[model samples]
Target: MSQLDTPRLPENASDLRSLYRAAEARAARLRVLVEAGQVLAGATPETLDAAVCEVARAAAHLAGYESGRVVEDRPGEAGDDNGLIFPLTSPGSDVTSPGALVLEGRRSAPSAEDREAVAVVCQLIGASLSARAREARLARLLGELLRGQEIERSRIAHELHDGVAQNAAALMRRLELASDGDPADLAKARDQARALVRELRRVIAGMRPPVLDDLGLVPALQHLAAEARASGMAIALEIAPDPGHRPPPAIETALFRIAQEALNNARAHAGPDVHVTLRLAYGAGRWRLSVRDDGCGFDPDAGRAAHDAGGLGLAYMRERIELLDGCLTITSAPGAGCSLLAEVPAA
Candidate 1:
């Protein structure tokens, strides 16, 4: 509640009535603010819209109105008087925003103090609405990420069934055939065993790179660069002066995945004879990983929109950083090289 000066003593009958009414309005406004605070405090993001209406009704009561109704001012359905409508701002809306609270006014109009009380409650409601919007967006992102994980799991299962399972069975058959003591069969069986090991390693690395677990991010990135170079892309790796502290395992994994996706995007879409650079930097208690490519680039907004609709590419990269409360930036334009930077504050 705001601090306000006390009312002066009335010197006449009309002045007394007016002063009493003013004092009563002030007291009612204080009560409304308290009730509105409690209502807003008790509200959850899921129930916030209803809670805003409750605050609006409380404001109406304070203004000496019999009843109030919260209404969204959609086109062609608003039948209420404009003067009685107190527009509630949405998370990022200006004046003329549609959501509002309407007092069922029949008697005298509300005073300035009463309107101010309404305004304060409306501001609180707006804040709560913003919170609700953020929570809802986060929930959606979590759901999409989970779905992406399930899809990845299915693909891995498919790979194992097709690659690993059949190769293992064939390797066993080769070993059984080699039991006959033929030197050629023995040599073939040994080669099959080595091929099986390599396949297993590839699959395991796809699931999670062993180097990432055994060494650290730098070594894992080196392995990644080696693999990328094997596919004809010139790669350069850079690391900042060591801050002598490694990011947590989760953060490290996120950084690696973001880099991986960025590299994959470049490999798929970037023009031929492209050179890609992966940079890792640590400074001021923050870790930054960036991937830049000297390949032909496209509009990031269009690419993001296309990938978002398909639930892949930059969308999932953004999801990984968002989960860690980090920032992901995509900088590119048509005919310009692309750069992606994912940065997280280190604790």
Candidate 2:
């Protein structure tokens, strides 16, 4: 055998025992790291606390501590002991309030290897928690973005519906009353004015339906269904008797916008005679809105790839749902219809 492949015998029994213990400790450290990685991989804002506790338990087991716990080191908390206390700090952050990992009931000071292993676990947990915090911050920002956009849309829609559309209708009436003009010219002018008014109304609806703000979501959806039917699309709406007693304004707005986008996509992509169904149901303190269309659907994988290349519609739907701590799911396949579903808490 090659010299590098040959195993060397230890000089003494003590040396052999030392080598064995070293190998065991190394293996334990590797196992702890693997566990830590798994925990971090599954960590999210909702399950962060449980994941941290699992990491701490594993750290304690590997470091030979009787028990371990993770404590949030808020101001005015008790001081930490001299034992293994790994401070969980995010990189390049001046804010040190993240907290610490505490290992208790240690018979003696931890060895260097043990300290290193525990530190690795602490680092993983800290980074994962930090990422979750950043995610929450980003979600809040997106929520604010959606709220601002909706408010602006509502303002513009109100202006167009009340101000511009009324003026156009009045102008059309004036054109009809004119007595000195050629009949054909007057008629053409009146037709053009009427078309303008209709187009403005459509624009107003697209900006933000006033019914959505005046009445609740159900009435707004009913109005939407009527408009769709007027446009020769077979659209049906099924709303719950009580949609969780009407969610918060933001939730309502997001759901409405999501449905609006889904419908627009169906109209654009779904072939003629596409039958679309919009359903809203409330149960268990949550509301679900689904839009399904029996139209020629594209491959979902191809759609996702296109989205990744810069499709904002689907991305916006997901962002809105995520901001509300909810879920958005789209299922579609070639020759199959597409279904868009969004569920959010009532509150």
Candidate 3:
């Protein structure tokens, strides 16, 4: 073989041995990371926690520690004094995560490579934990949606029993008493029939707005703005240029409902004379809807907590968007205005 193609060797036996040992150590570190990655990547919901623990165990063994324990990040709580704590970092965020991996004992300080391996393992764990938390939150929101549906049904039942049903019964009694052809009784029954029609129309609109099906989303929103304007509210509606293709029924319904609810909330909680703006924008393969009210705002954290305790607030909105692989965000403070934004992919 040519000299350039020949393999080179260390001049001394000790140097050769050292080189061999260094290569072996590098390979061992890489092998541990690979194995840990496999465990994490293939972990199912049932095996997630166990897989995380296994990764910790393997990392501890590689770090020259007897064992390791997970220490949750809590105020005024300290981890083991005798161990080295490696903070778990989230893949999405720069902050130190909720928990850390603490290697139990250090007869000698772990090498740089060992520390790096542990750090990487912690990142993997952080990402997995975040995903698990999101899954749990989504499940809770779904349960809330079901409960909200029941509550809505109860409200509709009450309206029917007290308003429509009661009015109908009174109209029937008036007609029966008017069998004598009395003009006053007949006129009263006619007025009652008209009133009943209006109430029925209101109920039907609440269930599903006719304008939405007949005129489409843009016109429906324009109708909404006109209604608000007639009620003496300063509101502006803006629609971005459309691609001329209507969104799927579910998307249209969701966006309209969200906008309606947001406007209602603004009217109820926002102080008098608060200006509101509603906008819809379209982008490549996605659409965005935003409602902003320059009114008295409230703590979003408190609102979210209230929903978690079953208040059916922004959490329900988020659940609706998330179901369509979308995102919903609410920004507000005690003095600042409230802005509710939702983005969904085109179907």
Candidate 4:
């Protein structure tokens, strides 16, 4: 009786000790998080990733892992090899699978004592690492988005300053010549002025597509389809009922921007012979914008990683959608085509 009871008492004591240690470790980690948060408050893109990596490595050490690194999860790097690959898995143990650890780590076996402790540590480490990864990703996306917006503004400024402004000056010159020439020349100059005015209006329309705000989502998509068809790309547009009746301004703006970005991407990078599809649908009080292009397709995940690092177009579209509480998903495989889907709450 003495031997059996003695064994029970030590086991209980060991359990209590484990609980105390775990609690203390958790408190210590919370303090570390507070410090990290303070640093993150003033962090910039150049230093954000490095900061996150340092925290992740520290967390790994605390969890008894040998090493930890921050990685971006993208095509060709999904699953175990994806973002922030940690050596939490075994030769084939699911206990260390990144996804599993993310969801919640479980014991490898009933009697696996050390594995249980490791699993808990993995959970804390994984949570912290994942949070840092997301923050870094968001920071990168914002930088790229701002860059794209600046480029667009510059392009528009140049077009107005060069194209429309030059043409208007030429029309003015012709008017002055007409004033000093024959009546016939004056009549010809008047005609020229009218034509120039029409051309200016067209340029303005290109600068700000009117259908986007005046006629709503379907009409804007239809106009885009018409423009694509004029460019030698076969275009198709489909709309579900109730999408255009009443939509949030933010959602409308996001969809318009995304559609414009998608078209520009297809034209600039995917070549002219691409087939394009623009669709808007309302379901369960949500609005979805989808753009599909049948051109040379690159890996969406890989492209997104590149985009997150610095590419402008897709990153801007994603940021715009995200700002409006929407979600952006891109799907593509090499030579298989690309589809971008954005969904926002209509309500």
Q: Estimate each model's TM-score.
A: 0.72, 0.54, 0.68, 0.62
* Deviation in Å, model 4, residue 109 alpha carbon: 18
Model 1 misplaced regions, further than 4 Å: 1-16, 27-116, 308-312
User: Residue 97's C-alpha lDDT in candidate 3?
Assistant: 57
Q: Per-residue lDDT for 37 in model 2?
A: 91
Model 3: per-residue lDDT, tens digit, 1-347? 89999988899999999999889878888988899889988998789889988988888888888787666873222346557777776787423356888788765567888788888888888777767777777688778788778866987899999999999999999999999999999999999999999999878876778999987788778888887898888999999875466788888888998887788778767789999999988888998999999998888987656423422467788878878889999999988989999999997
In model 3, which runs have C-alpha deviations exceeding 4 angstroms? 1-55, 66-131, 227-233, 303-311
Candidate 1, residues 1-347, lDDT tens digits: the string is 33466656778999989888888778878888888888988998777778877887787777667677666653222324423666665545322334666677645567787778877777666666666666666786777778768867886899899998998899899889889898998999888888889988998897789999888888888899998998888999998765566689989999998887777778878889989999999987789999999888888877666534422467667767866888899999878989989999886
Candidate 4, residue 151: lDDT? 75
| Cα error of candidate 4 at position 224, Å | 2.4
Which sections of candidate 4 miss by over 4 Å? 1-135, 242-244, 302-311
Report residue 184 deviation for candidate 2 (angstroms). 9.0
Instruction: Report the lDDT tens digits of candidate 2 across residue range 124-202.
Output: 8778877777677677667656755775677677877777777677676667666568787687667767767777776
Each prediction's total of clashing residue pairs, residues at least 3 apart in sequence or on different chains, is 0, 0, 0, 1
TM for candidate 4 is 0.62
Which residue pairs clash in candidate 4? Answer: 71-84
